[model samples]
Target: MANVLIIGAGGVGQVVAHKCAQVPEVFEKITLASRTKSKCDKIAEMLPRKIDTAQVDADHVGEMVALIEKVKPDMVINVALPYQDLHIMDACLETGVHYLDTANYEPPEEAKFEYKWQWAYHEKFEKAGLMALLGSGFDPGVTSVFTAYAKKHHFDRIKTLDILDCNAGDHGLPFATNFNPEINIREITANGRYWENGEWVTTKPMEEKRVFDFPEGIGEKDIYLLYHEELESLSKHLPEIERARFWMTFSPNYLKHLEVLQNVGMTSIEPIEFQGQEIAPIQFLKALLPDPASLGPLTKGKTCIGNIIRGSKDGQEKIYYVYNICDHQECYKEVQSQAISYTTGVPAMIGAKMMLEGKWMKPGVWNMEQMDPDPFMADLNQYGLPWQETWLDKPFR
Candidate 1:
């Protein structure tokens, strides 16, 4: 058992706290901290086991380091914003504690996000004899682990990979996002990219569309190809992959709202004068939108996300797909969160459990795929998010 500290109070953070409390054997003690102390206290109140709560600005390394020292947690699970990733990592390094986060680092002024910044800390973590796990959430987390499992058990060489993420949940509110409004809007409005033939290919936002028939009666939905951070690490870790792409399902209604917002410049990150004050249009728009955390009770439907790989095994070409389907209502019934947060949060707890058990403890920064997938796969079944596999005759592309 280990004492764990969670940083963040959003939907994902709430789910992470609840899930961690459920497994006392792995997490002997847990503390949930965030910029808002009430949010952390509220989430802690719902857990089956007692959990401590505190208020700290994750963006301030000094504050975070001080809190870490006070709590003396064995590990810190960062479910905070991408902008605070480096600060939390720095604090972890200072205190010689393990670090894990769901997303990669993205600059506050720029919408651009990449793994290079976090990957640069490999040597620092190694030197400090501490471990840092990057992208342990759903897409970059479970999806990456799915690819590694395929490579280990089914494929001799993986050449192509297509990661399909479908969120069929409806939050009742017409314009609310399933996660942080600013982060969600920025990610969708940015230029799309994919890896192919040793180079990055760019496209206009939501320009490339395809329809995928999801498994388990999830039906068909329109998916748009986008550049995700997972492609970078997957390409580097799996050299045999010649082409890699990430696609996400978007409803027509959602696209229409996004288009209107884009046309009115409401999605722009640039600051403009408003009422004699400078304000970012996108940030203003986020204020107008409903918070993702409040949608759990109203959200309904499911999310299907997984990886499809094409490779060769024993001189024979093979195609395999591994995925998980999570229902929002079911997730809410279990953990009082929608499927998006539940999907991401469950894996965060599992990864922490692996580290606490010393199954994946190492002194270096590592991606999810670098660790053994067997224990993770088993944990998926034991936990809330269960997965399934199927052999396809050909790639979805």
Candidate 2:
């Protein structure tokens, strides 16, 4: 058994706390923290067993260090905002604890996503003999591990990869994001990018669209090309891959509302003078949107996210697709959260388990694909998010 301190009490944080509590044999002691102690308290109440709760602004490194010193956890599971990742890492280093995060670090001032910021900490973590697992969420987490599993067991080499994320659930809102509104808006409105022929290619937001006939009755949906952080690391770690890209489905209703929001400058990240106060339009908009956690009970339907790879198994061209389907209401029934948070949070817990169990432990910061995939993949089915795999007749275009 190991002690764990989880940061952030948002929707994903709730799932992480619940999932961690469920595995008492692995996570013996649990403490949940966030900016608001009440949020942490609310989540702790939903858990099956008792757990400690605290409050700390993850943006402040000193505050995080103090909290880690107080809790003295064996590892810190970061489900906080992307901007606070580095600060949490700094605190974990000072407290001599291991680290794991769902999303990578994104500068608060810029609408960009890159792994360089966290990748720079490899030397520090290596010297300290502490392991830091980055991008342990669904896309960068499971999808990357899926690739490694394929490479290990199926493929002689992987040439091309396509990651598809589809959320067919509707929360009965005219406009809302599944997670944080500010982060969600910034990501969709940004330019799209993918890797091809060992080079980076860029496109206008939602420029490339495809209709995929999903399995298990999820049916066909419009998926658009987007520059997810996983594309960068997957290409780098799996250098044999010639092309790699990430795609996510969006409803027409969502696209129209987003367009209107963009035309009116409501999605802009830059702060402007408002009634003698400087406030980012997107931040203010986040205040007006529905909190993603509240949508759990209202949402219906399921989410499908997976990877399709085309490569050579024995000098003959072949294709393989592997993915998981999660239901919103089912997740809420189990963890009081929707599928988005459940999917991301489950992987975060499993990653922590792998580190604490010495299954994927090592010094230095590493992405999901850099580790062994079999054990993590096995845990997914044993946990809440079970995956399906099959041979594809055609390649994704």
Among these predicted structures, which one has the highest TM-score? 2
lDDT of 1 by residue, 75-175 (tens): 99999999999999999999989999999999988999799999999999999999999999998899999999999999999999999999988887778
- Identify the candidate with maximal lDDT: 2
lDDT of 2 by residue, 1-397 (tens): 9999999999999999999999999999999999999999988888899999999999999999999999999999999999999999999999899999999999988999999999999999999999999999898899999999999999998999999999999999899899999889999999999999989999999999999998899999999999999999998999999999999999999999999999999999999998999999999999999999999999999999999999998898889999999999999999989999999999999999999999999999999999999999999999989999999888998
The models' CA-based lDDT, in order, is 0.94, 0.95
In model 2, the Cα lDDT at residue 32 comes to 97
Candidate 2 residues lying further than 4 Å off, grouped into runs, are none
Clashes of each: 0, 0
Estimate the TM-score of every prediction.
Answer: 0.99, 0.99
lDDT of 2 at 85: 95
